[model samples]
Target: MPTLSMLYNTAIASAFVKILLFPCYRSTDFEVHRNWLAITHSLPLKEWYTSHISEWTLDYPPFFAWLEFTLSWIARLLGFDKAMLDPYNLNYVSTSTIVFQRSSVIVLELVLLYALCAYVRSMPARDQPNAILAAIDIFLSPALLIIDHIHFQYNGFLFGILMWSLVLAQKRETLLKSAALFAALLCFKHIYLYVAPAYFVFLLRTYCLSPSGYRIQFKNSIKLGATVIGIFLLAFGPWIYMGQMPQVFQRLFPFSRGLCHAYWAPNFWAMYAFADRVATFFLPRFGYSLPDAVNSALNGPTRGLVRDTVFTVLPNITPRLTFLITLFFQSLVLIKLFFRPTWRNFVGAVTLCGWLSYLFGWHVHEKAILIVIMPFGLLSLKDRRYLEAFRPLAVAGCISLFPLLFTPAEAPIKYLYTGLWVAILLKFNRAAPVPLKRQFLLTRVNLSYMAGFIPLLIYNGIVHRIVFGDRLEFLPLMLLSAYAAWGIFWSCISLIWLYFTDLD
Candidate 1:
């Protein structure tokens, strides 16, 4: 039976979305999303599968292109007009027509959302069915759906396939089905490559590791591998046979050198970017043109400052360098977990992998944080050992999301929804085992999280004054990093106290 909290959460989510439905459903990124659809639908068949297009739409995985192609054909059959959507002639397309076409995305997203909820509820829940539903509601709240659905991104589809894969894995129903689900996720988004390792780990543990001995179950492994390969071939085989593999890969994973996102998200990258900009201002001698006097001062007595500047700028390393560094750390973490093999450690390792990738990888979008945070948040809430680790993370995650409200220019509605969701999560957590007891530093941590937002507010106030100023956009991100930094600090202290308590 569902608890009152569960019922209330469901009702609230429904009411909230319905009330704000029109406002929340506006297409922010749908322009780009629609272009992707156009690329697939408007092009010739060969060109549709070929990825050497000069646009944002084709620069995605082959499976995504295939999906767009399929949808575009359906749209054409429905008599959708292309002249109306021509970016060159926005006036040509009536707003109502465009809205009608984009409505398909909302419809598809709703289906995916339903699948996600179903998968979450299907998870093994001994007695806390309400707790499980509440926990899922907390993660997949209106705010999240608004981001994925209204803002218009394929994250809904990717996350849907992911949750489906996880549910399949838990059931241990069919190895082929699980592999196919995972393979489909990979097709949906290349970022999901990080989670592929976890699938392997699971397969090794569940299927490859036989009870009789250390010998591998070659048959089951072969079956799983075959299913995964079959899905890949079905998605990519046609283009591969046509000798367009290079073009496909190039489009999907273009690793060009670029600056951090115009708007940074709170992570190591943004924090480093902030510190680097400051260091660059103070350091000298590398610029093309400067007065000799100023150059001399920078070159001569401030040599020590230059060295210090290097220290400050180190964290703001290039995306590729940061990618390698993050990869190294996550790999080490994954190895540690693979040996020890606890659910907490495994999820943490996977989260670290996905988080580090998003923070440091090239062409990252802020919203991608959901890829890691949502699943990890759900896992952390469900397990006892992960409770404290995730609580601070949850707080930090909420703080990180503040920039979204500002970016969308959402009014009080955004804040209200954010606050309500956070309160709901906290309330649900309070009822679970290892509830959030008001302990030492709890208030301080929350205060610190709130305090981190100040730099962003100040940065925003002064943004227009600077010449090359959009650095302010990074301020909120830096605050989020500070939140995470503080969370880690407090977590370490908590661990030390727990150790002593155990000894006592």
Candidate 2:
């Protein structure tokens, strides 16, 4: 078991590394939040969502806008010029601005650190070592490093709130508190809506209805419903009062962005895109030609556009179809949780829900892979099967974010840092006792597939630059996406199988 001092030391070390990464590569996301800070600071409350001075409009929920508003005050105190808050101050990258934004992420991540400590303390004495390992896994997560520290986002703070909610929901006594925290989380970042189904169904079955007899408990249901409604009302009340509901909804659910993201998130859709490419390649050999429109869509993903994706050999996926597919898979998992309603089952359902949504959701972002990886890490502590699946998924999913930080400066950092984290996790797993007999074939295949990442990284980082240069620019990204997709797809299957077959 890790002592409190040990946990504090881990957090301090993690924060120190994040501080060192302050000058590392940052994505357009840095500018996005800067824009938000500008919008929230300069614009009036009514113009918060309506302002279009910058392309990165205040699309996040009002609470997050409020959060930015709150942070801007502190930003101003830290020597950021008030002129930077101008609505049209696009791409403002002053030294003070950079330090302030990066510092905010580091400070706010303390929330995640606290939540991690609380979760570890909540565990049983025998499970503390595993909990500590899980905490380390999350703290040193490559995805978090790339997205939050380097690429730049507030996912650490957002995911911290999520971790707290999950910990609260783990016990029957804190169910209401859990619901309130989750409701707050949704308002903070609506991206979490993807996994909302699990929370809904779990609370409905275990809290709102009798667990053994399946009878409705109206009082409990009413309390849960009211708590959720109150939170939403608090979040949206001002917008509703101003009659900006339509604009708010539009900003929140921008279905116009299309099916797959610019970089195809390593999910079912990436495989679909790869399959379409294969068919497009072989169809000429089979004496078949695709329609020009279909062929045009095939070029879209390769070009990395944030628009509707068209398929040459497969049916173009509609937002509705993606939604239904996501819901269907989530329903299957939620129904299982509905029956069992154990803490492990609930956590499994949450992980599956996030995984299914990420796999099939429309306009998915590569950063959203953290949605699956974080909660799944929690489950990995309890079962060796989950750890087995988690090992490869973590590696592939984290590496898939590499293209986001493709600069020479960040390339080595991403690989070296992730390599070290993977080594630690692998060492820990090897040292832990396994109750189930090892499946040698599966182990060999998983290791082989994980090993392939080495060559893939080499090719993307070194060979591609040396050989083809910028001509085949998208080839490395495509290969990375396709390869990572295979691992994630397999991990999803492995987890679903474990969910059904493995008994508590």
- CA lDDT, every model vs. true structure: 0.55, 0.86
**What is the clash tally of candidate 1?**
2
- Return the lDDT, model 2, position 211: 73
**Candidate 1 on 1-504: residue-level lDDT in tens?**
554355446645654564444445345365555666666666665676453343344666677877877776776677777553343332233554455445654555454455545555665566356445544554455446556544556565566666655555544555457678778878777788866666676567666766444578898878877888888898888888888888778767665534344345445555565455445555554663333434433432123221211223333245557668767756665565455444444445556667666655665555666666556654554534345554555555554555555544564555566556656655555544563543434644554654565565454434443643653343444445545545533543443333223211
Give the per-residue lDDT of model 2 (tens digit) for 348-438.
Answer: 8888999999999888898999999999888776756678888878989999998899788987798899999888877776535575756
TM-score of each: 0.76, 0.96
- So what's the TM-score on candidate 1? 0.76
- What 10-residue stretch in candidate 1 is worst by lDDT? 301-310
lDDT of 2 at 179: 92
User: Model 2 — TM-score against the truth?
Assistant: 0.96
